[model samples]
Target: MNGSHETEIRELMKSYFDGLYHSSSDILRTVFHPDLAYVNGTTGNYEHLDFEEYMARIDARTPPASRGDVREEIIERIAFKGDRIGIVEARMTMMGRNYQDLLTIINTDDGWRVLTKVFSFVERKA
Candidate 1:
């Protein structure tokens, strides 16, 4: 694993977590590719959103920070298939749920950007 790539990916993940916590689409745009896909299958049916739809939803949401929700996030693992491809396993809590995210990233001309995010979440217990 290249140390520089790992560091870059870590920083990107941090930005991702912060974006969700703050519901900042501007911040998220820096980390997610324009054509990124957001997918979830926690329920029996599959849910999918393209980058635009996802960003719209984020823009409309009440940020967790505004509600004083405690921010929790962890980068469980990062693995690279080569110099340009990486996979990050992460966990975070938001919107009264704990989310497990599998993020696929690519080293683009601009930098490292998340290409796809497949995630699932479970409601937090009271």
Candidate 2:
């Protein structure tokens, strides 16, 4: 990966983590593509969402920050397919769940944006 690309992607992930922690769709919009695909299958049934649907869910949720939850986020790995495409593996804990996300990112005229997110999570032990 180009150093600049790595730096930009890391910044994008920071926005992503903050978005989830705050449940702020406005912040998320800055880092995600308008046509983003969101998918999950941890419950044995495949589910999919477009950007609007994902944002709606985010908007409806109580922010972890509001609940005084401790934020935990990690960028586990990053790899490039070419100059304009990359993949990121990330982990975060929020809302009593620990999540792992595979994010496909693309470099657009607007800079790096998450094109898709496929994620799975396990409920945290109380």
Model number with the top TM-score: 1
lDDT of 2 by residue, 1-126 (tens): 589899999999999999999999999999999999999957884799999999999999999999999899999999999999989999999999999999999999999999999999999999
Model 2 residue 20 lDDT? 93
Candidate 1 per-residue C-alpha lDDT over 12-70 given as tens digits, one digit per residue, 9 for 90 to 100: 99899999999999999999999999999698747999999999999999999999999
TM-score of 2: 0.96
Model 2 Cα shift for residue 24 (angstroms) = 0.3
- Scanning candidate 1 in windows of ten residues, the lowest lDDT window is 38-47
TM-score of each: 0.97, 0.96
Summing lDDT over every window of 10 consecutive residues in candidate 2, give the lowest-scoring window. 38-47
RMSD of 2: 0.9
User: CA lDDT of 42 in candidate 1?
Assistant: 91
